[model samples]
Target: MHGPASSGWLLVALCAMTGTYCLTRMRGGGATEQRRAAGGEALMGFGMAAMAVPAAVFTPPSWAWSVYAALFTAAALPALWAARAGAHHLHHLVGAAAMVYMSVVMAGSPARAHGGGGSGVPLLTGALLLYFAGYVLLTGVRLVPVAAVAGRNGGGGSAGWGDRPELTRACRLSMGIAMVAMLLTL
Candidate 1:
């Protein structure tokens, strides 16, 4: 069996994938989808990477931390506005909060040889993990049938993203898993 030490790489890879997904979502026109894909997602990717790969953000200039904090906090605001529309907005809000928490952890901690140490708040981490895990399980169940349908149709269906059930569910599941991976590194 693989050891726990090796698992960090998987989390790192997931972070990269989440970043890529965010960028791709920028190109997609779905209102809800695009809303979740806000610019803060790239920062979310960076925040997660910093957690998994110690060197990634261990020693940036002081101002970078401030920017990250501001950006992530700002990102969460819209999610509040979007929350009335659906649970996905709530996910975004949580994701943004995670990013902000991460930024604070990174900014305050001094760089060290092994990853930099910070005051990791367990309560927050646990909450994030729980939420994301549920999201992944739900997403996985949704994807099973979508694969069969897509195969039969030769690809994604012709319906608009809002009209396509699979697309939104897939995105939710993807980000949820990504968030879980990120939280694990903390």
Candidate 2:
């Protein structure tokens, strides 16, 4: 198994895929389908949260951290707003909170690292990764039930061609990416 600190990029890749899938579904132009696509936003939130774990663990340059911080914040605001519109899917709320928590963790990392006596980078990163793994695992598992619900309702109907496999595959991809990234850190 891959170590925890390296998993950030996997999270980024997963977020990217999840975001892409969501955007594609949103473009389908069916209100119901579009509403369903909002789930992607939650995935993105989880992915981004996963990403922060590595970034914090790896301690990339200050600039990269800043960029990630800004992008994550921008991405999460809409997710929170979207959650407000669809309160039934608690995933939205959890995902949004995860993303926001990631942002805080990312912002606080530098200070934490600096405060450490010396050479605590690895420990810091490991903690971040652990948090991310937990977040991803929980969020990722949470999505399965939602997707199943969608599949049972109408997601597996005619729209199945466009939605089911793509969403399901995207979830797997996200987990895989996070796993790979974490391994790389070792």
Candidate 3:
């Protein structure tokens, strides 16, 4: 209940729904890449929920910072390793790192000290926001109508989940926006 409760719930619902979609995607029997994508979706789903609480309540447990920071940090490593595979992997790496950064920031405060102000905003926070904003926009544009985002891993046509590129891009875009919302609340 820090910002508008409705907005908070909206984010929560969005994240949860997307996460469930990811879960379904996870079960999606395709290539290794499809499974990886599904895993990221699940993370975003739960991650959004984690962020949603603080967005609404304006307060998160002190321990949550360490937990999220560590979780995202751990998530980042695999993403980095996968980066050699393609540009999408690079994006995933960056996204994971962004989550880590946000977690660390929230952990340090844990009481909404950074709320709606510029006095104490970290320099890195700005950079992170810039990256995510660009990511959201880029993902959005790439998903225009019939145009598919590249490096889907599921290959083209009849690939089931991977066959539909928009869903994949939407997941990334949604998480990026969610991350921005979480950062602003911090």
Compare the candidates by lDDT and give the number of the best one.
3
Mark the regions of model 2 whose C-alpha exceeds 4 Å error after superposition. 1-13, 32-59, 63-85, 88-90, 111-161, 165-186
Minimum summed lDDT over a 10-residue window in model 3 is located at 111-120
Q: Candidate 1 residues 113-134, lDDT tens each?
A: 1253334677877887887798
Write candidate 3's Cα lDDT for 1-186 as tens digits. Answer: 124677777778778877877876777666888788679768867876766763535566678778887887887788888889888778778777777766665666555543444323567777777887888888788878756555565453334554566786787678778877766665
Can you give the TM-score per candidate against the true fold?
0.67, 0.46, 0.81
For model 3 the local lDDT of residue 2 reads 26
Provide C-alpha RMSD values for all models, in order: 4.9, 7.5, 4.5
Residue 127's lDDT in candidate 3 = 78
What is the model-wide C-alpha lDDT for candidate 3?
Answer: 0.70
Best by TM-score: 3
The local lDDT score (0 to 100) that residue 59 gets in candidate 1 is 47
True-structure lDDT of candidate 1 = 0.62
* Predicted candidate 1, C-alpha RMSD: 4.9
Full-model lDDT for every candidate: 0.62, 0.49, 0.70
